[model samples]
Target: MPQHRALLIGASNYDMRGIHSLPFIPGDLARLGSALRRRGFKDVQVLSQLEGGKQLGANFIKGCVAGFLRRAGRGDTLVIVLSGHGVHAAGRDYLVPEDIHEDTHPFESGCVPIDWGRDLDETPADHVVFLIDACREGIEVASMSVAGVTQWGRQKTDAALRRKVAYVYGCSPAQLSLYVRDHEAVTDGVQCGTVPGESFSIFSRAISDVVTSHQGALALDVFREAVQERVSLLHQAYRKRGNPQLLRTITDIPHNAFTFLPAAAGRHEAATPPVTEYPATPSRSTSPWWSTPASPPSGLRPQPALTRTAEEDRLIPPAPSHSAAPGRGQAAGPVGLPPRLRGSSPGPRHLISRRRVLLGLAGTVLTGVGFTAWKVIDASTPDRQLWKFNTREFVQSSPAVAGGVVYVGSGDGKLYAVDAATGEEHWSFATGEWDASSPSDSAVKSSPAVADGVVYVGSQNKKLYAVDAATGKKRWSFATGGEVYSSPAVAGGVVYVGSRDEKLYAVDAATGDERWSFATGDRVDSSPTVTKGVVYVGSSNDKLYAVDAATGDERWSFATDFHVESSPTVADGVVYIGSYDAHLYAVKT
Candidate 1:
C-alpha cells in the first residue's frame, strides 16, 4: 500500500497582542493529526503555536507543499487540515497563519495570497483533501452561514501546480465563528466566566467529527451536511440567546470537485446536474358573478312617455307649473322612506331601536352560553398528543425519550426537558458555555446522552458531567485532559466518553470514578457505540477500532483514507462509518 502524508496547521496564538488563552486551533490540529495517523498516514505533521514559529506564513505553505511532494504519487492521496483565523478581502479568502498579526493586512505582513494548487506542482496525488476552519468575512450570513465556504479556488495561471483538490470550509463568507464558555463552570472567574471570542469554529469541529466518525466515508456531500448541521446548531444557539449577529464563513478550493458523492470516483465528474422545474398553476377570476347582474324588483311604477312631432315640438309648447301636482317632491320612493308623525305605526326609528334591543339581549345570552360550552369541552379534551419541538438548532445528539419527556442538549449550553407530546419545555439546565469547549473564541458543539435517570454529557469545559436527568441538576463532574466533544455512551454499568485529551475514558456508572482510559494519538471525539461484546468508535487518529467492551482491548481495527470523526453506527453485523478521505466504509466482524 502507498504511504499517505498530511500537514495539519492549527494556529492558536496570533502575533497581535491578546490573551494567550485556550483556543481550539491547536486542539483541532492535534485531532486532525491523530486521525490521519490512525488512517495509516505514515507521516502526519502538526504545526501549532506551541511549536513556536514566527514565520508561519512561509512555514505552512512550505510544509504542505513538501508533504504533498514527498508522499504524493499516482494512486496516493494528500490531506491538509488548517484550523485558524481566516478572512476574505477583495473577494478572495486567506487563511491566517500562527504568526499573523490581526492589526496588519494579509498583503502587508500576514500570509500572502496562495492559490489552492500552489503546492500541487510536481505531485501526482490521486486526491487532495483540504479542510479549512475559518471565518469568511463579506456575504449574507442567514442562508449561506449554515454551510461553510463550498466554492473552491479557481484554476489560475499555475498550470503545473493545478490538480484535483477537494476543499471544505467551516462557514460561509458572511457568518462568524463563535466561542463561548465551557459547560461545567458556575463561578464567574476567568476559567468560569464568559470567554470573549468565537469559540467553536463550526466548520472545523464538524469536519473533525464527521471525518473521525465516518472513517473513510468522508465524501464531499457528507462533509457539507455535517458542516451545515453544525452551523445551523450554532446559529440557533446564538439566536436563542438573542445574539443572531454572530456568524462565520466557509469556502472551498477546486470548487467544481467539492460535491456529495457515494464514493471517491463520484467526485471526479465535472458537470453540475440540471435542476428540475415544476409547472405553473392556472389562473382564476376573482368576481363571484362575472356573467350577469341581479334584476330589479317587480311592482314599481313606470315613467310616462312624451308625445310630440319633431317639427311641432321644436316650434311651440309650454306648461303651467302650478297645475302639475301637489307635494310631488315628497312622495314615497324606493330611495327614501315616507314622512311620518311621532306616533305613526311602525316608524323606521322605532323599529330600529326595538331590533337593536333584541339583538343586544340575544348576543349577550349566546356569548355566555358559548363560552360555558367551550370551557367544558376544553376541560374534557386530553393533552396527551405527541409534541414536535422545532428547534432552529441541530439536535446532533440522540435524545433520551422517556417518562413522557424528551431530554436533549443544545449547542446553546442548555439541557432541556420538553413534554414529548406537546413540545413544551418542562425544565432546562444551563451550562454557561458552548458544548465544545474550544477556547473563549469558539462555540460549544457537544451533545448530551442520558441513561439510568442520569444525563451524561461532555462540555467544552474539558470535563464530563453526570447530572440528574429529571431535575437537570449536576451530580458529579470529572475533569479530563482536553475538551470533551464526544457524547457519553453507557453500557455494562459503565460510561464511555472520548475527550480532546486524546483518551477514551471508561467511568463508573454509579460514581464518577475513572475505571480506565485508552489513550489515542489524537483527540477522540468519536462517541463509543457498544454492541454485543465490543465497543466500536472512530478517532481523530483515523482508525476505526473494535475494542473489547469490558477491557478496552483492541479487537479489530480498520484504517481509512483520512480522518474519522464520524461516530460508528452498528447494524446487523456490519459497522458503517464515514471519513474525511471522502469515502464511507462498511466493515464486518
Candidate 2:
C-alpha cells in the first residue's frame, strides 16, 4: 500500500528586524495540518517557532527535511511545505529560519537552500510536492540587495519510477504573498476570536477553501488552478474594497490528474476514515463522474452563441458602450454566476474585444480601424473611406505600422502584413492552425511591436514570436508557461512582455534568450515601457511597478483602486497610466 507523508514548516518570527513577523503563520500551520490529516495524511509533522516553541535553524531544517524524505519509500508520496521569508541571493533560493539574522550570508549560515530535487531525485517516493508560501524578495532586509526565487520548471531528466513532481508557489517568483487581515471573509466556520489577529496568507486561505469545499478526491492540477483563479478574483475584490494587497500562484505541475487529497464530510472535514492506501490515478474505464462535463443547472439556458461570419467563425463581441449593471430580476452580481461566488463583472478592459484594434498607416496617410470589419479611412478626411480588408475572424489585436506596412492579428490565429498604400496583403503568418471546437484557440490578441526590422507579437499559444518584418517569417519564439496576452515592448536590445503566468519577462531581443523576469501579484497583461533605465508596467494586482531595466529589481510600486492593464506612457519624467477604477494617474518617474 502507498503511504502519504507531509512536513510543514512555518517560520513566523524572524531574528532580523527587517523581516516582518507573520502573526498568522501559526494559524495557517494548524489549518493545513488538520486539512491534510482529514485527506488521509495521518503522519503530518509541523515545525514552527510560534507553535512548536523551538528555534528553527538552517541545520535543524535540513535534518528534518532529510529525515522526512528518508522515511518515504517506493509507492509513497511526500509533501513538503515551507511558509516563511524566502530569499534569492547569489543566484540561489533560500528559506529563512527563525534564527536567521542580517549579519551573515546565506552561504555560511541562517538559511537553507531550496535545491529540493537534488535529494528528491534519490528518494524512493513515486511523487513529491512542494507548497511554498513566502515572499520571493529578500531585498527588504537592508543587508541583502538581490531577491527572488528561480521560476519552477521540471527538466526532462528524472528518475524513471518517480511518476510526478509538483511545485505550487504562493506567488510568482518575485511577487509577494500577502497575509490577509480579514481572513473570515474568505473562509467558512471561523470563530471570531479564535487566535486573536487570526489571519492567513491569501494562498493558504485559497488552498483551504478548495480542499474543504469538495466532497471527493481533489486532483493536484485542479487544486492549483482553482486556487490561482480564486486568489486572482479575490485580489480584484480586495482592490475594489480599498485594500492594496493581492496575490496569485505560480506552478510547474501539469494536468496528469493526480489526486492529492481524499475528501471527507463538511467544510472542516472533522470526521475522516483511516488511510489504507494512497489514491491512485483512476483508469478511463473507472473514471470519476466529475471527469466528464456536467450539464448546466436546471432552468439555466446554454450561453447564446455569438453571431458568426460567413466562414462559421465566431465574431468577437462588440465593446460595451458603458459599464454593465445587473439586469432586472438579477441579484447585484455577475449575471451568470451563483450568488456565493458572484461580484461585479469587470469592464471591457477585463474581456478581450475586437473593436480595440486600430493603427495609423503613414505610407497611405490612412487610419485603419478593425471594428468588426477592417477598414482604412483617409487621415485628412475621417469620413472618406480608402480601402477595406476582410479577415476570416474578428481582428482582435491592434495593428502595428512599420516601413510602409501594416501588421495586425486576428482571432483566426493569423498575423497579416499588408501594403500600407493599397491595403493589399504582403504576407500572412499563421500563429497556429485553427481548431473547430475552440475557434479562439491560439488567438493572436496581443498587439504587434515592431523594432529593428523584427515584429514581436504574442499569441494564445503561450509564445512570444519575433517575426522578420520584411519577409513575415518566424525568426524566434519564446515559450512561456501561460498564454501571452500582453503585447511586446522592445528597447535597449531587450524585448519586454507580460504573460498570464503572472510574470513580466525580459528577453534578449536578438537571441531570444531570457534576461530576467519580474513576477507580479497577478497576471501581467500590461505592456511595459522602458525609459531612462527603468521599466514601468502595470499588473492585474492593481498596481503600477517601476523596475530596474537591467536587474529586474523593483524600485517602487504605486497602487490603484483597480487592475491596471493600460500600457504606461512616459513624458517629461512622468508616467501616465489608467485603471479599471475609472481613474487616470500621472506619477513622477
Candidate models: Cα lDDT each: 0.50, 0.63
Cα deviation at 461, candidate 1, in Å, is 1.6
| lDDT of each residue in 1-589, candidate 1, tens digit only | 5445677766556555431333555555554455444445667777665443444664566566566565566756666766555544443555656555444532323553435444455566655666665553322323212222333221122322322555555532233454433331111111110122224444454444344333233445445554554344434433323322222222222222222222212222342111121111111121111111122112221111112223322322222233312311111111101111111122121111112233222122111100110111232344312224543233444555667666666545566776655567778766564433222211134666778898788766677888887787888888898767788888978888888778888898888999888877767878888889788888866788888878888888898744577899999999999865456899996
TM-score of every model?
0.39, 0.45
As a whole number from 0 to 100, the lDDT of residue 291 in candidate 2 is: 19
Show where candidate 2 strays beyond 4 Å. 50-52, 106-109, 136-139, 148-163, 182-197, 236-253, 265-589
RMSD of 1: 30.5
Provide the global lDDT of candidate 2 against the true structure: 0.63
lDDT of 2 by residue, 377-422 (tens): 3333334335567676656588778887888887778888887667
Among these predictions, the greatest lDDT belongs to 2
